[model samples]
Target: MWPRGDDDIIRSNSLHESWSTGALNIDMLFPTDYFLFQVAVCSALLSAVSPLRPAYSTALENALRNELFVDRNYSLLQRPSQQVDVRVSLTLLTVNELNVKDQFLSESGYLSFSWQDSRLSWSNTSATSQDYSNIDSLFSTELYVWTPALIIENSIQDMSVISDTKIPMRITQDGWVFWSPSGVYKVSCESDITYYPMDTQTCYLKISTWGYSKSEIGLSLEIGTPVDDSFYRENGEWDLLSVAGHPPIVNARKGTWYSSLGFSVTLRRKPIFHVINTLFPVILMGFLIPMVYKLPTDSGEKMGYCLTVLLAYAVYLTLISDDIPSTSKTVCLLSVYLGLTLTFSTVSVNIVIYILYAHFEGDKEVPAWIDNGVRKFGRFTRREKRDQNKVKPSTKEEHCDDKKLTAILENEENNNEEHKPITYREYSDILNTFFFVLYMAAMIILTIIFLLPLLINYLTNG
Candidate 1:
């Protein structure tokens, strides 16, 4: 019913129809149609390529061995031997979006990436779908070939580049790529964000990719909102993302990147200590020196020793100030020392005044008005009473004789005693050297406890 060439075509058409229609009659009439049709197709292919069979067979075997046809189903009729070239590339971009949730501090920025496949289309003269698909395969198979770099740029003069050389990039089914170089970044202070001296301004991060591809290379950056975690990292590790880069410039400055990730830190001014050391010892010692005034003036060591403490405090003040910074805001513990020293000097001055007054006035009993008002209100009641009471009256008549006469006699006696002052040896037993030693000990202890902490806080914080 059909010609020879038409017979093969008719047979192929009938077989296809029976297969598609699932005909029960074909199963009985042509039980071997599927097998026969496959044989006929193989015979025709072999006859048509018989002259180049060897060349074609070798090429087909090479392609299969090379895994070029792994995605195709193979049959005896026709063997595919075509191979495509896949090209790939990766690019990194810097992201500059502010993170609103955070105060622009912790987790301030991260790396992100954009991936593109060039093997989606096949072409020799120009890139085709096959070329894109092949390029994508390279990405899928060689996920470890990608690396990321972060480029930081801002309005400030100092911009730093943060790099994590150990990035591992992997492509997902949808062609999205991801990676992260975990760490916090330190951005320079900005003035526009806040007026405070230490206010942190705007900062951003970008994600990028690095790799060895030519055609299929691409990168994308996502701008992150500013955040505030300036103190420390909330999570132990940096979050994972793609290509990371710095945000846009808010205020630029000269900057370099240091490899610390825990917190953003800054330096403060150091505290001065010279004044504190000098004054504290003097004041503490000075307070106790007044106690020495309680001793009789006849005691040779009282004034001399008090004078020595005053001089020592002055010397300490001068020495300590040399080491302190002139512009420091905090009052040095040394200043406290100096204050104490000056206070003791004042006490010494009081002692000197008391001794001079005692020596020049003689043992005349003080006048009732002088005793009740001036001496009592002037902070010298005890000394005045003791000095005036030492001399005895000759008689009741002499004591009551004209009050003026008594006063004159007392003055003459006080002047005579001043003219014949007591020697240091005669009053040595009355002097208490132990009080001076105790004063020094208290000062040392107080300095150690109070001054040390202030100094430590100043130095550490500052």
Candidate 2:
């Protein structure tokens, strides 16, 4: 009734001293004052002993106790009914890893299941009479009640019914039970790496009633959005595009119908890391394949350059092999592009060796094909140059003088000025130019065919 402070303690101490010295009279104090004094003494004693402890509300406790006691004999082994519908939803938290080679995906999330149990129902009037009107729900461990055993149908882990005693179930007054348990799930996913680094994968998380048939336990998503990603952690290698839930599939076996619900998760590969580590280097090496022709045949580095690029491609192919599963159902276009580039490099090396032989150990007369090709190429080039330069053609007198000069040079076999015929060395030069244009064009075409889709997807999706 009154604020107790240092003043109260001083007053009490003074009274005690007076009483001890016989200087105070109890008759002088009023009945109200005497009662107040007694109250102050008790307060002081209690404060000296320990601080006041907080009292908890018993409504929630009583509700939980009553619910658990009533369901103490509830058999978790039995189904609630022959037609219990369980609404299941998923909350995706993390995309830990998706092993392409193992064909399995690892993820951590929560599975929420809600259904009605007729035996667990109670009246609101009873709860209100028990002083638990504010407490609308009671919680009990999952092991204490019957639960629809929903198992991951495509799980690669132990195919057991999900049970976590530590996780509790929420039960309302109207027998509606809601249970949500979180765990790491590893499920089988058939990976299609046809586009590889720039590929988009659609993985599914399939759920089914383990022991109960469709007639006993049916699954559905009452909510519009069944798969939630509000708490999803971003994965470094893959970008989650969309998550969609599908209705349970009804299949009949031996006159028994079963149901399975699937959640489709579409994930696109993040091309930046793979591009820098694998694709960029492979493309860079591909460009080097055509550069082999630019080197002069006499430089003796042409063959070496081709072989070096070819070896680099071989190493890249081996590296890619580790990332993708070995299956012949479908081949990756990236691998095919690399194989084609490698083949071009090998053919270039062979052609170079042949050119070298022709240049060093061939006869004086050039091959007819080479000669004709060279002459035609020269004529086309000279004609273009002449047109571009706007130069006048040679006159009749000049033509006659050129003919007489050519005859004199042909007749003089012992002349000191020796006239050299077109040789294989010239042919090698022409072939080098031809090969340069050919392989560079091939590289460009291969890049467009293989990597262009990746670029388009990355840009469009990102």
Model 2 agreement with the true structure over 39-153: per-residue lDDT tens digits: 9889999988754532336755664456545534566776777789999898999888888888888999989899998666654444432333345677888767888877888
What residue runs in model 2 are displaced by over 4 Å at the alpha carbon?
Answer: 1-73, 124-134, 252-255, 369-421, 460-462
Q: TM-scores, in order shown? A: 0.31, 0.75
What digit string (tens of lDDT, one per residue) describes model 1 on residues 149-219? 33433213224444454555554433344444444443333222111111123333322222212122222
Clashes of each: 83, 0
Lowest summed lDDT across 10 adjacent residues in model 1 is found at 79-88
Positional deviation of residue 122's Cα in model 2 after best superposition, in angstroms: 1.2
- The predictions' CA RMSDs to the true structure, in order, are 16.7, 11.6
Question: Number of the top candidate by lDDT?
Answer: 2
Q: For candidate 2, what is the lDDT?
A: 0.77
